[model samples]
Target chain A: MKKRDIILVAAVLILAGGIWLITRVFFNDSGGQLRITVDNEIYGTYDLKQDQEIQIGTTNTCEIKGGKVTMIQADCPDHICMHSAAIDKDGGTIVCMPNRVFLEIVGQEDGGVDTIAQ
Target chain B: MKNKIAFLGLFAALAIILGYVESLLPVFIGIPGIKLGLTNLVIVFILYLYSWKEALLISVVRILAIGFLFGNLYSILFSLAGGVLSLFVMYFMRKIPGFSVLGVSVAGGVTHNIGQLFVAAFVVTNFKLMYYLPVLLVSGVVTGLLIGMVSGEIWKHVGAYIRKNNREKL
Candidate 1:
């Protein structure tokens, strides 16, 4: 309603827009690998180019098909994980909170920097 | 003194009931950590109608009660971070002249999401979680605007009633 209020809203909108642009441009690496972790431990990494099914500790199941990873099923009551969309780009994630399972996409370039410096 | 305590208790209960109602709604948005934050309506109402100290007390007590009733340790941690951070921001913003309730609530909503994101990043040690900022920020603004408008209306009636009662007592 006031000048200050308009400034605050505009600032927030611009910040959000900037973050959206950065994520879209720099973070969306399509050739990313799917990294699955269960109970805070690394379960395994699978190539997004391959099709496979992963079962995590009898609590959740994930499927990688056609270059996308999805939580196919879960034992959690809400099934929020199962409802989450498939992830095929870097920085995307599917989390099963009740099961303590986390799946994320990591671009191949993510670790390349460390390997190159070494 | 007794009346003050009674009103605080009433506000806390109202906040908790609003939280319960929000939890019952199906996730219209599939994204996690996105909610209408209906309970904040009460907190914002208290901020305008009473002192910041009272608003802070009600907010903390409501989050703790909700955590005990329906959440685990993890939920408690995130809610504590979000609720405390937002309350501080809202209180500070309210002190600045020329800022409307809408602006204060908008700041509160956005910061609440940011605070939760910080906790999530710390828990997972993944900074990439920042990628969710855009969605969360937009949702925050929308929900904050809605809550702020509702609270503005409630404040009109409640503020008048409280002023009348205090004047009568004197």
Candidate 2:
């Protein structure tokens, strides 16, 4: 590897590290709302504080209890959705690839970040 | 012309086979979207031994064929985004005088992840997915390094043969 090669690799690693540090420092989860989508369309948004079971188009079922959401049941073959850990934090995401379903926790404070970044 | 077309077909097929073999192995990492990117070996090899056009053609054809055969529609979209972005980055990086094949591959790997994440964000409509960027960056470097090293070795032996055959045909 040449000097420029080293420099380029270093630059990427440093940039990645910087992003990670920024996110970690600002990371805050205060019982955010859970947003779910299916096939790239909005399915529903549920309050994390509320306890309810969501049946997502017969493909998967998500249960929210004690301010945490988890995929309790899914018809997808891999069951990777069900295996994902419960999410209650500001940016935690659970995705069901087979069904094209996605779930993530969005805090009120960070809502503007998405729009601004876009 | 015939030799170039045959070489393209052979490389495309090799890429598809590598992709299929990778899919067969169960992912031990819990993180989604992480893979060995074994098919990239073929892409890197082509980029060094041939032109970017040939490499790009092989990458696109392999992704489309493999996606239809072994993956879903969503997968096709993701792979298209990642593969094209990676190829673009590698192509330009190879032009830089000081960049080695390893550097080009690492850049490709990193951009590939960024491209896939962009698609994920768009599909999920969630920008918070950026949180996964750091992990992906590290994985991209590690996997890219390995793939580049392997590709370099393969190119050392096979590259001359391909070039010689093309010249002979001409």
Predicted structure with the largest lDDT when compared to the true one: 2
- Relative to the unseen true structure, what is the C-alpha lDDT of residue B115 in candidate 2, on a scale of 0 to 100? 92
lDDT of 2 by residue, A28-96 (tens): 433479999999999999988789999999889999998889999999899998999888754689999
**lDDT per model vs. reference:** 0.84, 0.84
**Estimated TM-score per prediction?**
0.71, 0.70
Q: For model 1, what is the alpha-carbon lDDT of residue A37?
A: 90
True contacts kept of each: 0.69, 0.60
Badly placed stretches (over 4 Å) of model 2 are A30-118, B168-170
Q: Which ten residues in a row have the lowest lDDT in candidate 1 chain A?
A: A109-118
Q: Which ten residues in a row have the lowest lDDT in candidate 2 chain B?
A: B161-170
If you assessed candidate 1 against the hidden native complex, which CAPRI class would it receive? acceptable
